[model samples]
Target: MAQWYQTWNKPLKNILWWLVIIGMVVSLPLAYTRHQTETSANQVEFVFDYRDLLDISDIQTNPRTFVAEQLKNMKAAGISSMAVYESTLAELKESRRIEVYNSRDAAALTQTLGDPNENFTYVLFADSATQQKLEPLIQKTFADLKVGTKPWSFKNRNGLIIQMSMDDASIKGMDPDPMTLQMLKDQGFQIVVRLSNRRPFVTNEMDRLLKQLHDIGVKRIIVDGNEVPGYTEENTEINLNKMADLLNKNGIGLAAIELLKEPQKGFSTLSKQTNYNVVRLHSFTEKDGEKLTEPLKKSELQDRIQGVADRLVLAVKDRNIRMVFLNARPVKSLDKGKLVDPLAAYYESLQGKDGAIPRIQEVGFKLGPAEPFDVKTTGWQKIARIFILLGGVSLIVLMVSFFVPEATLLLFVLGILGLAALHTLSANLYAQGLALSTAISAPSIAIMLAIRSVRSGAAAKWKSGLAYALWTLIKTSAISLIGVVYEVALLNHVTYLLVLQQFRGVGVLHLLPIAIAGVYLLFFSENNTYRDKIANIRSILSSFISVLWIVVAGVALAAVYYYLSRTGNEGQASTLEKLFRSFLENTLGVRPRTKEFLFAHPLFLLGAYLSVRYRHAVYLIFIGVIGQLSIVDTFAHLHTPLHISLIRISYGLVFGALIGLVLIAAWEIIIRSWKRWVPQLSK
Candidate 1:
């Protein structure tokens, strides 16, 4: 026992023993917990759509200049107690506030002899009385005084609001100075001309005003200050319907109409009555400016934005409206002459269902905290523990294989199978959406076992296999580590796109480590001249047979498989079995139809090719039994007849023969070169 331990122990350098033991011990808890968590992990996905409800598509018109000029006209009216405030560039930059210049600044600046130092326009806010006062001033300065006001106040001031109504005589007597009006008009000024006097077109007054407005070529009008008479709750519907029909028939495609009271009570009724497609209107107004126009706090803004978004969604869903036309007071109002705007919030909230709105979907389970001890209710720990335990057992078996040199062949077979089995398990776990912890750990036992066995045996014969396994383990570990790190940190939508890019990079680099290991193994081993000659001869003959008969058989079987897979044949499974059995019988001389003569003939290169033929026979049989089906084909695109033919012919004939040639050349060189470094191990 001591001697076996000594032999095995010496090969695994002291540093490696400590590393293996410590690394495994530390990884146990993490691996166990990771697997448990992975099993419980679930992804929640939701999809929302609000295209028909919030008809952003309908509002696509050029309103930029119109809004700017309207704000300008409001300022020019000299509406007392109304002020025009300028938003600084810095403020605009910080808040994305769209600043509109008032006509007062436009008129004053134009009349100045030189350009003013300031380069800003004003936003105006006033009560109804003040607005009416400003209307005459605008009429005096501008050719068209299109004055408008709601029955209720819609400005950011904290005082009593009084509304004044003038008689026809007073309106007729108010003559605007032509030159002043022209100057005001040149400075982008206009009138907020009111149409109704506390009621809609009574006593032929509406017809007369409409005629005057048409004669003057007035394009925009604000039909405000109209209060519909006597709402008997029961007949309100009839009256509202009458109003909508009348407005629609009149061809009034103006910007706004101030509705004095709630035309309809229910959300559905409001949606149906409000003709957003025709014009926007403000129904409710503030009597106390301080109460209505107050700036929202940060929290208030967030809540209001969310509430508005929710209401908008509900309105769209219930009303069957294509677009929404909001009252302009939200943006028009000001506090202490300063406009309190929530432009960012408003814009962000308006994003339709698919754009930014959260979708409602099913969520199965709540996620628990991810900690070593506190990992709540994920299956990662159980599964990870199993893999870690398997790895530990594999390691112990690997150590045993080191001393039991005769068991080396069995260990090698197990190692190869283990690698394949673990990788397949990893892929399955990944497909199931299990977290990284559920994946079987890549076995380093392969390298450890190979090092222990080869360090004590005839090195030349099996050292290549050991080197191959060693490099594969290292490559896989590096790849997995990098992939895990990337997944952990990736979150944003932009970075998610890079996932495919990273995979491409990894795939391109995959072959390099194997080539490097092959080179290292070739150079590091002691070489025998006689063995090199024999091995080379064997390699050449094997390559020829592999390229010819073996390749032909592979191509034929592959063609059958491809056809069967595409046709979705039920008989293909049994046919595959027969084909594989036949192939095995032909290559290994194992079935009733075996050719004894071929196995016995000395000229047939029996001893040199027997192992290759036997192994390939088994491999071919296995391939046939586990024939690639259409479902599998869809994923890997592996059943292409052309690709299969090319792989067999090119890899088997050209590359295989070339590989044999390279091995021969390398063996000969190694025989000469390695003699100086290492003595050949003798059985």
Candidate 2:
């Protein structure tokens, strides 16, 4: 028998290697899909209502102070810097100006003529209407005085470059009664003026406008994501350098805001340039803006807002940029002085602190560490619970060893009542269940009994090699299917919530009785004796741990369950997935179902054959029920209703019985051939 077993080692080794290859093939795609679902992000930096802060400005007298004070609030709120959009105010074609009708015709007439230099001159028109009216005649003399309106939308757009002053005529209503830029500078805010309405007019009024901007506090000028006059692919470098030199002469610097540009390349190039003091990127994200604007309940909106901020924190970490300009416009207007930091509330929620400025130090610069989204227990608590559950299981093992059937049943009823009473007394502490405990313990007891049965039936002389081979197969198959069952529950409840409160803890106590009976017959029986059981333990444990196929299958099934059924999990799954789940519930009012058709009945026949062929394998009968237990246990989840669990059991009985019949026939033939061949080989 030993020689015969030795012949199969090479094939076993080959199959073991194949298992690794198959596991990777099945698991990688599932893992990748799950990662995709979990790791999505929002690209915006902030999500808030600008109107929410108007009433809280430190300087109430200056309307412009609201902008400056709010800028300070952002810094206090942990924003590294900010990018403010600037005006595209165009002077009438005939004069030096900052405002004109937001129109396509005015856009075309103000085009600057010279290859961007300090020497360019501007031609002023009496009015933009007159400028377009005389374009036919004006073209003859001033060929370089360009005019068109490709940039401005028909909708009114006021160009407030920065809310500089209520008093400046040039920026009057655009930034009337707004925050002071100097206040932002005094508070150590790195201010970036994004050139929103890009030039013909920017270059047309470049020198004087830039001078006025520099005298106050504006330093860096954002040149990207803005269309400048004659901004061509070939002249990008020249245009960028010219803008930098213009800002440099005013004791200012250039900043690049990458909107649609390649992030790494744009950031890398701008970062390397000495004149570029601050390089950043800004775009309002969809989920951060539009989605949040949808008609959601107040709590849902807050959750979405926090989600956006978390993604923004991640975006900063990923890009290593200094500032992000989230379009705060989409954030629905809030009540004046609601004590919300609009965007900062997101980080505050995670840290559980108000107005915290801590940055995510590891990400180099960010709002702060992402906080735990859910509550979790400490390690000692988990260990203590496991100990209690094992104690409960151990009690059942004791009962089966010492008590008669009637006594065991009677005590179980009393114990359950006592437990329910205790649960009521400790309602504050929550109703604790032994489900996880039983989920773990039932398979162990089943395997242990199956092995004890094999040892008890062994030849009077121990260590019959042929007998060991048969025992190994039975052990492997039983242990392999442990905790293995088709998942069919309709709810998305996690089956193992440690803090669960329910009366179901007593239900799993039933397994304790089975464990007890098996313990007496398999280990402590007067007929079988302890010495024989001791002889079999090593083989049983070795076979249990060493079977690779079952271990791999168990792991694969776990991943599949998580991938398909986890909360927020979506697959190629739809109604069909629901139907597949329902099909496994193993029940019918008058007919048998899945469990009976696929597992229990077949297990029963196969187990019966194995038990009769090898008396020591008699525990296969209970092990077969363990397979049924696996089915009921799955539906036995607290989240599943009890009626469904019974239906699932019946399904298992019918389907399993059918499959068990087939497995029995195949196993009978295999065992007969093995027995016949063993005698011939023994010679």
Candidate 3:
């Protein structure tokens, strides 16, 4: 033993350990309390939408002034684009007719007036005799025929979408506007011409409409796919592609298709065109299973907006796309001809509760650098500060242990308290989610714990195979679980939507933990002997290989999940999947744990439990660490909630531990049975 080891006093060490514990218990909650307010992460949601020119234009008023005001409001509200119709069918001359119908034709029209939802105004040219023959029907249908030279209109659940026909196929653009669109353009406006088809989905007249918008300086087109009802699987893609091509020729560069299905092949091909644009629109058309309309309660309106915002962050995180369009008329339900308002409710939805914006810049998206921010996060900087703080604490632990060997208990207590304090400080400081901070710190903690465990025993007893696996798993899981609390701090302050946007991965955070672990292992020679140093290196390298195996195993598991979901028998997964499903169905009740929870957490927990004592328990526990990776992978997708992730990992720890105990019990039983059978065979 070293001379310094002999001088270490037991009583002093115990007192120091208790002091560290006392300090931690008090400071940790204080940090949590300081950061307990609502989320303040800054990120701008780039949202745009289409508004009816009728929203601001009224034939009854000075339409130009109203439209210009709406446009200016749009610019101020951070709206990236705006859309208006070339013209509705009701606006066309062909839809209106001056008819002095004979009494017989009027009688026939009167018979057909029962339902107004069906298309009406069919043109008929018949002799006087034929009209007389058809005049015996009810007078109800004739009521429509008596009204001469007026436009026909319809009302549906959406209030009104006026239909019109092309009066002259040659007239491309809309009727004259109040202000030159060139002004909006000069101010950096992106105007899209919405082609409202009275005819179904085919773009027979679209070629003409595109020319008019192009002539009017409109650069984008929003196509309503429902307008094209005649297309099939074979022709829809081709027809859409052709429409896109037509738009390109007219110098209309962007096409936004509001299709309900996955985009067809032709759209994919057209999207690649240099001048052609296809914004894959995911519209929040429904609220509580009904289409969005006015007259909804204020609470319902707020809920719907929040729900859409949450989905937006989740939907676009890794999609590799630049823009998203929200199809909404979130302004209060205005009366007909009452469209002179900017969508204030819609803009309110863009912000989370208390106007908490996430860190859009951290997610590698910056709409405008000069845009003012009410909130911001330290991002990777806070993580670096955390790791540095942790490293200092670790060094203090090492130095104290080196001089006073009897102070081992105190050092251990100090380490835990320091880690807890660090966790509290980081949770308070970064204001992003906690998983990233935890994930970055985990591997280092595992390395340090593994070193401590190995130093306490004979090196050879734990050097190879199952022993190494057990050690790695236990150490890894303990640290991973430690990281879980970091996110628990954030649960009440933000929604899953804001959390996903702000808490996206940092490259430094991903690599720092592994780097810290690697560097620490290099100098952490077991027993301070050259032989032990080589062994420690070898062991750590083996641990790295195991970590690689865990990673590969995670990927392989994902591939298997995908394949099973897509190609399994009748699309049914294997029994193991079913078992997880059953477990979740029973335990999670209606809340529903995801496949990540079912597959990953329990397995990691199992690894953690098995890692307790058995020499080969690490093999089982390795799966648990893989579970942690699965959880980490879930974050990359930006879909899982912070609380949900916590629940999943916590359940995994408990359930996995139970499973491990069950397996160990069964194994012991099998061993006893084998012994008895062998003795009988020998006899």
RMSD of candidates 1 onward, in order: 27.8, 23.4, 18.9
Tell me, by lDDT, which candidate is best: 3
TM-score of each model, in listed order: 0.24, 0.31, 0.38
Q: What is candidate 2's TM-score against the reference?
A: 0.31
Residue ranges of candidate 2 with Cα displaced over 4 Å: 1-75, 80-82, 88-180, 186-188, 201-215, 224-239, 247-287, 293-299, 330-683
lDDT of 2 by residue, 404-439 (tens): 322333444454566556556773232233333333
Best-first order by lDDT: 3, 2, 1
lDDT of 1 by residue, 532-623 (tens): 74676577567745467888889877965564353321333455655554454333322211111111111112111221223222221111
Each model's lDDT comes to 0.31, 0.40, 0.42
Worst 10 residues of 1 by lDDT: 45-54
Clashes found in each candidate (C-alpha, N, C closer than 3 A): 22, 47, 27
Local lDDT at 436 for model 1:
20
* Candidate rank order under TM-score: 3, 2, 1
Better model by lDDT: candidate 2 vs candidate 3: 3
Per-residue lDDT of 193 in model 1 = 32
Name the weakest run of 10 consecutive residues (lDDT summed) in model 3: 156-165
Q: Over the stretch 615-634, how does candidate 3's per-residue lDDT look in tens digits?
A: 34333333333354443433
